[model samples]
Target: MSSSRIGLRFFQNSRAAFRNATGPFRRPGAQGFRFQSSDAASAEQQSTFQRLWNSPIGVKTVHFWAPVMKWALVIAGISDLGRPAEKLSLTQNGALTATGIIWTRWCMIITPKNYLLAAVNFFLGCVGVVQVTRIFNYRRSLKDSPVETVKELETEVVDQAKAVASEAEAAVKKSN
Candidate 1:
């Protein structure tokens, strides 16, 4: 079977198990009434409910970030890499250090305003770095929290099932 079909089968089995374990908590006669419905109609209703309840909430948010961050990083890295080459060019002597010194002096003489501009750029770059870090961290936390929540929910369901089973067993023993 395809992965999605396998996933659907697993989901259906888990939901059925959950329902069976929590049967006593449901309204009296609800199960009997539900089972009397036409099979196709019931299946359709169950599928609709599953789609509504089980859809992941963060997928759209992740999709929005994926391309945005990818392009942002690519552009940022390319532009940053070009900065040094643009500012410093090789001299006729082919001395890299001398060329860099010449470029520094040239920048100071030709664009005194560049000092302020550089400061502003540096500040903005720092802000961008922090923002990107926070977004990455937020995504990681979002990924982790849901898994933890699902595990906790499953544990609670199992515990409730065990409690119900024990109660039922005790009641049966008493009746006998």
Candidate 2:
């Protein structure tokens, strides 16, 4: 037999194996319905997630939250950059934690047999906590560090005072 024929035979056998494992859809009463493509306008109403996800506010929120969540994922190290959707900021992390808690509760309620998902939810919440603390610690250390200037401490202090005075003067004029 030719190489191409052999390859085709292999493909046919694999297809047969797949079909045998699970019966084709729309076969009969026990079988599932056949898949069909449908336009959005003519089809069933969109899912809650799909509706919100395509909206302007949803787009903006995902874009903004992605960066913050990315940073947190970086700190976690074990997490994948592409996983969990976005880099949520500290505030967004709170939302994420709440989501995890809700999912855990849902899994517990829906199926006690599937405790694995609940465990995953618990881990998700922990990651959010760690991410928030890491962000805070990093920011606090960055703020306290004296790496910005070559000038002495006193010169830096004097310069800041002048800047504050000028800002105050501007504010006073603005109020007039």
Judge candidate 1 against the unseen true structure and give its global Cα lDDT, from 0 to 1. 0.46
Model 1 agreement with the true structure over 1-176: per-residue lDDT tens digits: 69999999999998877655535566443443322333456456676555434223222333224434444433553354334332322221123223333443543564223333233334334434444344334444655675665565457557767998999999999999
Per-prediction TM-score to the true structure, in the order listed: 0.20, 0.31
* Residue ranges of candidate 1 with Cα displaced over 4 Å: 1-113, 144-176
Worst lDDT window (10 residues) for model 2? 29-38
lDDT of 2 by residue, 1-176 (tens): 89999999999998766544544543333221122223446225777666556443343454334434544433553353234333435555555567667766876686223355566666676776666555455444555554432234346447767998999999999999
Name every residue pair that clashes in candidate 1. none
Global Cα lDDT for candidate 2: 0.54
Segments of candidate 2 deviating more than 4 angstroms: 1-77, 80-88, 142-176
